[model samples]
Target: MSGAKSVSPENRTVIGLTFGNSNSSIAYTVDDKAEVIANEDGDRQIPTILSYVDGDEYYGQQAKAFLIRNPNNTVAYFRDFLGKDFEHIDPTHNHASAHPKDVDGAVSFTIKDKAEEDAEPSTVSVSEVATRYLRRLVGSASDYLGKKVTSAVITVPTNFNDKQKAALLAAANAADLEVLQLISEPVAAALAYDARPEAQVEDKIVVVAELGGTRSDVAVIASRQGMYTVLATAHDYEFNGVALDKILMDHFAKEFLKRNPSAKDPRENARGLAKLKFEAEATKRALSIGANASFSVESLSDGIDFASTINRLRYETLSRTVFEGINRLVESVIKKAGLDVLDVDEVILSGGTAHTPRIASNFSNIFPQTTRILAPSTNPYAINPSELGARGAALQASLIQDYEADDIDQSTHAAVTTVAHISNAIGVVSLNAAGEEIFVPVVPAETAVPAKRTVHVAAPKDGGDVLVKFVEGNTHIKVTKPEPKPKEDKTAKVEDAADSDEESDFSDDDEEEEEKREKVWKIGNTLAEAAIRNVKKGGKVEVTVQVNADLSVILTTREVGAQGGVRGQLNA
Candidate 1:
């Protein structure tokens, strides 16, 4: 977890926490900026794990290391089991660690405080485990902030039931953390993207794709004004980071077996399998940023040392189907929301698994060229996918920290679409994105009213007097087929064979073209207009639009680096 630094807690302020099955993060916001806090170990993405060894407790990344060495005494993958009964909880994810058992119809884990053979196992409820984890998380935040953090807006998956949320709240209370708000993960992701410096608060349908270590989840949301409504969601457990890691493990294991024919497979050996898995996971992460990564494991199987190297191309080739699976998951979730691919305006990739370039490229192929795909691997301005939720929660915490709890509840539960809105989109008529004279919306249609938005547009290249016009308008797609290219004369062959060899150079650029999409802004009735004169060359012009509930428009215009110019009000 990380961001542009702006914060510290004073007098027990609220923080933001994102507790996932595989990892957890903490963040705080100040001056409208959120910064993720690291634990004492200097780890931002702390693993959601706890371990017991020799009667001592460990948490976070430190605890993750003992999962293999003290498997039976370590607890993991219990986040989803909170407030869930034995019948509803799945134990497959905990097979490598402490196995959860049904105790009095409630899900619990039996783990020992010590790794000794004679140490008796104690039954720990999932709630208590979560409480302990939360306690540690708060402690870490306190140490960093130099003050106690007693409250937080923790994020949860959309599928979280009322009982689960209540259970989480109770756990947080036991851990000395007040539950400020339990926001949905996808909405939090959208909030984070909106808070970026260059991001425009446009109305769009966004798909938040979260590919975790154990599972993958995708949510389709409608973002209007400053509100986000989740339209649909889908979850898949079979395709995830672990599946990709297994592909690499299987590939390298085959190589090991070939080198030592008599050795047993690493999968059949417990110690060797652990070593192989650890190395394979590391290799997968390494290949995400670099073109090549090497895998090394000592005494992997039957006491045989294994060493191998795989390029990103080979690794991605082997995991092509896995990337395609993730892309398909996004597409399926969007369709589940009763919309096609074209309706999606933006896609935000969340979780550490999204670091893979192949996954982003696969999504780019599925989405239209106009669709903005946000990921560290795809968008230059996108934040780390792993920290999006936490940062969003922190920003939310900053937004409502001082409000009354009841008022916060009522405001959050209220539907944003219920508010009165203008009859048409109140926007500015100017140069469109393509330099075509058209209307560009600052505050889009269906925006909840009494709304105000500020936008900066390019003044004329050699600036002078800038007339900014406010119009009530909407955008419609304009489809146009390009004129056929001049047909190449295939019959006229090059006389020299060497000249024909040079023809291959242009082959890469000879891709088949198709129908193109152009966004055309359809101008409507003008509301008002204002002029700002004497703008510097290449300077930006600032225009502010405020659409009130009475269908009135207030326009403010000024050159960015100059004194204020003019303001006007017009009625519909």
Candidate 2:
């Protein structure tokens, strides 16, 4: 409440907020790049956690340390319960803390202010918890910026419903932050990789996978004419980086048990289990960077110290099933968009879990050779995945922070506008090196009318006249498998089994057929056709398409640098 302020175009100071379920990050841009701000304790990746000691507030990593010693007073993992009833929410992750309970029909936690045995605990609603966390976050940003933060663009998950957004907005408002916009986590990641709406970027498809501490989300997006459309998405709450940490914890727990036959299971003891969890997470982070890491905990269980070491390969082997499952999740999301492995042009990995090299290698194995992976394990130039969401939101805030509030609201409000949108993509049909029909989209589907898009079409390799046909297109994958090598005759079954050469050839061919499943693009209905003649070799054609609010379409075509372009209108 102390930091609340009014924003004007001249005095606006905007920041980005990524309110993740497990961790939250804040960022701001001074030039072209967004820098994630570190708190006074020097943590860019701050834990979304809070603790109470004698009514004093503790936050971020500092609060996280209290989980082991003062679990009863610490609050963690409360982001997912916002805007939901106590009866409908799950509290599995809250067992180590002051667990969520129904208080006046709302999700709330009872936290004791002091360690005194008879002290009464206070009931705090989930919304209040979120508001307190946001206040601290925004206050930190203000201290770092040397100015009062006026507005922010926050990132949320795609699965967040309308009620959740409203609740988050209310919490932000209570924290003295003006809500500029609420962006999707995947879309924010995409923007961090330079997918700006005003840039004239080529059309392509991208898969954004965010494997977080508590959940995993994969999205299939189409980037057409500088506009992005989220075609499909998938989410999993049970699988993520926590699962990997549990594996390491269990490994050391079992080792401790084997070494000390007289002691009970460390997991059965709350403090011992907490130590294992903390060390396991540290070891997991260590393994992300080096070939080998050591796990050590002092006075782990039953007055015994536990120490162990694990190599990267050993860790990978233990977590191989998780890697495989993540790959399957990625594959299923792509397919849900009616696409194949080859159709994805780029794969952007986000979140802390994506730092694992094994996960990057798993992604490499599933996507095609041409697909570019923007992860530290694959691309040396890629941004840190953990900071992508916040950075994107910051970039967006910087771009629109100078605009008038009324104008910004009008552009993003769906109910306030009378504009219509096209339901399908419009593109040109061309021939590739093999003379196969290739549809080059200029206007993507769901573009609001009246809309306009421009693209340059290349001439034939030898530089001849080009004929381009404008068509309305719907994406459909046509699978093509090579003809299988003729099967061995039944009479030669025994001979073939004994002949190693024939068996090797058959196996090789069969594997090739099974693995080379190509997703070929097929041409859709033609809407208009235009031909440019007398173009010199190495010449290029410029094509522009525009759709009016009345659903009428107009197309213009001409050779680059040539006068008097051709223009035609058609009623659809």
Candidate 3:
């Protein structure tokens, strides 16, 4: 149960927030209608950016304005790395910048001190910056409502890990906001779609494609009466609004360099690159609506201005790969749900980036059912396209605060009745034929929560204590062996190759050479070990795994077919 469930709506000040990768917004319900709250600048969605001026902080629109003038002092895309280590390998994470550094395994930024320009800058954790921005967000909402706000329901990506969830919670706590519930973004969008007055019907298969600034979430949901069940979800970390921005930015940079032969490359200039990126975003948005659009950035490179025009055809050509990737991801999720494109009765499109014309064309190309597509502007009373997730979150908050057990049946919020299933397989560690430790998934991830499964594993020939290690996410986790040190002359080439993202040309083909192998990475905290004292070397042990709605994982081990067992809880 959520904390908001215990607080009556009349007694508590609650709001819903969407903490997106590149933007954030807040909303609340008034007279049973969801209303988005505008920030102090009168904007419903604010840029997820923060800038430091002489040790002082500026956020949102103000912070984004500093990107070109003070690139080192402004931070964007910090959300991508939250609850993540430095070694995480998404395209955004690998982009190097002097602004951010890893401090004691956490992300921190170095910013200038305006009070003392020549003095050394200071470092602050990413979480601290996030907290300050969240404080600003809630403060603005409080001002708009003319009341103090305490509780909130926030939305996150479907595949967020435990570390990310914990970090977000910490930031919310720092802002003096109690998170009533952290719901998945797709689930929230579905709730909003189903709540429409005209949407009443029998059970139907609905697919939601939410493309935001930083990521894309595709979910196939089964909605019957008022109950919603998530069948499967697929997402892409690299295919997003920022990636499209990069393409446009690169195109403009090339045009800029071509116009000025003596000027330094715009890509090499931090401020110039930032300016180009800002304009690139505007151009992309304009091209979404118009056949052709022109872009200009003043003083883009060493006092030289840049201006260029891109037609829709050219823009689409540049983004062909990304557009195709979205198609594949959508098809994959449908296949995972054991349904065909025709089986989907309705396809709801949400998020700001999904407004692009090409996205709609692609969807029509894939679904070929023009009438079934639900555009963002379908309802007059519905939440804004960009605010759909947050608005749905607002309704969920209301349901939790106002409704009793019996009265909740009419609510369309999925969090009230739906069970979000896991997306990957869970298994125990075992040795393969070549004696390499590998993961053997006994219970797949798509199983509904509050579910249990039992499997048996053979004891090692030497038979002492059997190790019970659970693996999650990827099953094939590669273990790279350290290459032997080569001669001094050969080391330089090896170093260059290692630093690059390309695969090495050298191949090992000796018949006797061992094949490269990988093992399953363990998940959660508890790794149980059961003693097999009197059993024979070839004996077996029974392992039972159970998952609860709270995501708690329990592992119980006993002798094969035995009743009593040793139990342990895995920490997530």
As for lDDT, the candidate ahead, 1 or 2, is: 2
Question: In candidate 2, which residue pairs get closer than 3 Å at backbone N, Cα or C atoms, i.e. clash?
Answer: none
Error of 2 at 457 (Å): 5.3
- How many residue pairs clash per model? 0, 0, 2
The best candidate in terms of lDDT: 2
- Count residue pairs with overlapping backbones in model 1: 0
RMSD of each: 8.4, 5.4, 15.3
Q: What is the RMSD of candidate 3?
A: 15.3
Worst 10 residues of 1 by lDDT: 1-10
lDDT of each: 0.80, 0.83, 0.72
Q: In model 2, what lDDT does residue 320 have?
A: 71
Best by TM-score: 2
Instruction: Evaluate model 1: give its TM-score.
Output: 0.75
lDDT head-to-head 2 vs 3, winner = 2
Over 522-551, each residue of candidate 3 has an lDDT whose tens digit, in order, gives: 443224554545445677878777877776
What's the distance in Å from true for residue 431, model 1?
19
Tens digit per residue, CA lDDT, model 1, 373-437: 99888899888999999999998888877766656666764432134555456778778567888
lDDT of 2 by residue, 1-572 (tens): 12323366787889998988789999999766788999889999999999998778999999999989989889998898989888889888888787998987799988886667687888889999999999999999999999988799898888888888888888888888887777888878988887343434766788999999888999887765545667789998766898899999999899999999988899998999888988999999999999999999988988899899999989988887777778878999988877777878899999999999988877776776799998998988788999999998998888778876665665653311223667677889878889888888888765656778889988786776678799987666555665655676645644654563433321322234343556544568888898888777888888999998798999999989999778899886
